[model samples]
Target: MSSINAQRLTVLAGPSGVGKGSVKALIQQHYPWVWLSVSATTRSPRPGETDGVDYHFVSHERFEEMIAAGEFLEWASFSGNLYGTPRGPVERQLEAGLPALLEIDLQGARQVRVSMPEAQLVFLAPPSWEELVRRLTGRGTEDAATIERRLSAAREELTAEPEFDHTIVNVSVEQAATELVELLGSPVKAAH
Candidate 1:
C-alpha cells in the first residue's frame, strides 16, 4: 500500500504462540521509539513477567471497575480471563506523533476496529497450522490444559486473519519484524 503516518495506531492481533512477543520484543529493541501499549489483564503473571510492564496485572474487581468506567479502548475475555487496552496511553502517544502499537487478541482487535476506525489492524501468522500447534506445545510453561485452551483460542483467532488489513507470516522473528516495519511505513494513513 499506502504509506503509514508516524502517528498511526497499529494493532498486532494473531494466534497465541505465533511468536508475537518475540517479534514485538525484537521490534522494540531495534526501534525503541515505537509506543508499545501494555495491556491490562486479570490473568496471573507468568514467570519472568512483570506486573505493569508485561501487563497491568489487576485484581478481577479492578478490571471490572475499569471496564465499567469505559477506560479501555477495547476489552475482551480470552481463555476465561479478561484483557484490555487502556484508552489514555495510546491516545497520548498518537497525539504526540508516535506510532502506537497494541498487541492484543482478535476480539479486542475487532473492538478497536469499531471504536477507532482509523487504527490499522495487522495479523501475524505462523507458517502453518501444524507449526502453530508445535510452537504452542513447545512453550512448555503452560500445563497441558492451559496449552490446549490456548491452541483452541489460536484456531479461532486465525480464522479472522482476513479481517485484518495485512498479515505477516512469522517464520523468522527478525525478518518478520523488518517486514512489519515496512508494512507500517507503506500505509500513509491509519485504517480500520
Candidate 2:
C-alpha cells in the first residue's frame, strides 16, 4: 500500500465515559492549529451545544441528502442516531496542511480506516470497568436505562481496541490529550 503525505488524519476513538470529550477539549484548547472535524448528526443537540460547533445539527432529510450525495468521509448510526464526518471540510483542512482529527466512535473509526487507509487510528481505553461505570454514572446525563445501554456499547468498543494502530489508556484526560498532541505532531509516512 502507498503511504500518505506527512499531513496525516488522526482518529481518537473510545467507549463512552472514557473521556473522549475531555481529550477533545484539551486538543482544542492547547493545540489550536490542529483541526478537528465537526460531525453532522441527525440527533437533537443537548442544552448548550451549538450548531456547527458540537455538531452540524441537521434534519434526517438533510443527513440522508448528504449521504446520497456521497458527501461524507464516513457515516454510521449509533444510539439510534445517524452521525457522519463531512467530506469537504476535512479535505479543505488537509489541503491547507493542517492535521485533521476526528473524535468519533469505534464504528465510525472503522469506516474511516476502510475509506482512508492513511488515517491513524488511536484507541482510548479506561483504567478499569469500575472506573468507567463511575464516570458514566457520575456524568448524570443518562438515566438508568440509557446508562446501561451505553455501558453495553462500551463493552463492545473495548473489545475492538486491538484493531487500532495505537492504544492509550485514558486515566487522565490531560495526559491522554498531551499524548494525542504528540501523535499529531509526528510526521506521517507515505506508506505505513
Candidate 3:
C-alpha cells in the first residue's frame, strides 16, 4: 500500500449494541498490524474493564482540561459522559505509517469526520431492529432506564447510516471483522 493508504484512519461507528467492540477485538487478535486507538472517557469503568486497555478512564475535570488544551482529535458528550480520542497517539501511529482504527459512537465519529476529512467511516449495523433490542437488553450491564435511553439513541443512529462511507451488517462477528480489515486495506499478520 502507498504511504497515504497505510496511514489512512478508519472510524468504526454505529448504534449501541451493534457489537463494535466485538468486531474490534477480533481485529486486534487477528490483525496486529492495524493500530487501534483507545479513547479517554469520564465514565466509570465497567466490570472487567481495565484502565488503559478498555479506556483511559479519567475524571470530569481532567477530561475538561484535555478539551481546553486541544489534546483531543475528537470529543463528545454521550450518555451523560465525556469521551474523546487523544490526538497524540493517533498522530504518532499515522506518522509511523500504520493504519489506525477508532471504534467510537456516532457523535465521536461525526467529530472525527470534521477534524480528519480523510477518515473512512464505517457503520456497523445490526441484523435487525429486534436483534439490536435483544442485544442491548441481553447485555444485562445497564439498568432498564439506561437501556431505554440507548434504544432511543440507536433509532437516531440508524438514520445516520447514509452518512457513513460503508455499511457492515454485523450478522457474525468474524464476518464483520474480516470486512473491516478488508476496508482498512491492511493485510492480516496472523489469525488467532
Candidate 4:
C-alpha cells in the first residue's frame, strides 16, 4: 500500500475504565515507533496529569479558535468539557509512514468515522460489565454521583461496540497491547 493508503490512523475507544490508557502506555513503551496522538481538552488536569502528556489542556476559547481554524480531525463536547484530536500531528506521522493511534472517546470516534471512513476504529472492551463497574469504582478519583454518571456513559459506550471495526477485550494488559499493536499492522517486539 502507498504511504497515504497505509496511514493506519487507528482509533482506540472504550468506556471510562476499560484500560485503554494502560494498553496504549504498554504499546508506547515496547514499540516507540507508534505515534499516539495527544488530544486537546478544555477540562482541568486531574491529580497526576500533565499538560501535553495527558492532554493539551487548552482554554475553552483557545479550543474554539482551533475548531474555527479546522485544526481538529475530530472533536466533541462531553460533560461540559471539549476534547479533540489535533489534525497536524496525526497528519505528520502518517505522512512519515508511521502508524498513528488516537485514544479517544466514543463521540470522537464517531466523528473520526465521519471525517475519515478509512480509519480503523477499535473498541477496547472490559471482560465483563461487573468488572467494568469494579474498575470505575476502584479509581477513587470521582464522587459517588460522578461514578454513576461514568457508568451510565459506559453502558452507552458498550452498546456501540458494533460500530467499531475491531474489538479487543482487555483481559490482560500484555494481551490487549499485543492485540492493539497487531491491529495497527506492526510487529510486536519483546514486552518489557
Q: Poorest 10 consecutive residues of model 4 by lDDT?
A: 183-192
Looking at model 4, the pairs that clash are: none
**Which rank order by lDDT, best down to worst?**
3, 4, 2, 1
Off by over 4 Å in 2: 1-6, 186-192
lDDT of each: 0.86, 0.87, 0.91, 0.89
Q: What shift in Å separates residue 162 of candidate 2 from its native position after superposition? A: 0.8
Q: State TM-scores per candidate.
A: 0.86, 0.89, 0.89, 0.89
lDDT accuracy of residue 182 in candidate 3: 82
Q: Which 10-residue window of candidate 1 scores lowest in summed lDDT?
A: 183-192
TM-score of 2: 0.89
lDDT of 3 by residue, 99-186 (tens): 8999998888999999999888999999999999999999989999999999999999999999998999999999999888888775
What is the alpha-carbon lDDT for the whole of candidate 1? 0.86
- Candidate 4: tens digits of C-alpha lDDT, residues 1-192: 223234679999999999998998998888786789999999999999999988999999999999999999999988799989999999898888778999888989999998888899999999999999999999988999999999999999999999998899999999998888777765334423
Error at 140, model 1, angstroms: 2.6
lDDT (10s digit) by residue, model 1, range 1-192: 666776788899898899888989998887766668999999999999998789999989999999899899999887688989999999998897778888887888999999898999999999999999999998778899998888888988889998999899999999888887766553233331
Off by over 4 Å in 3: 1-4, 187-192
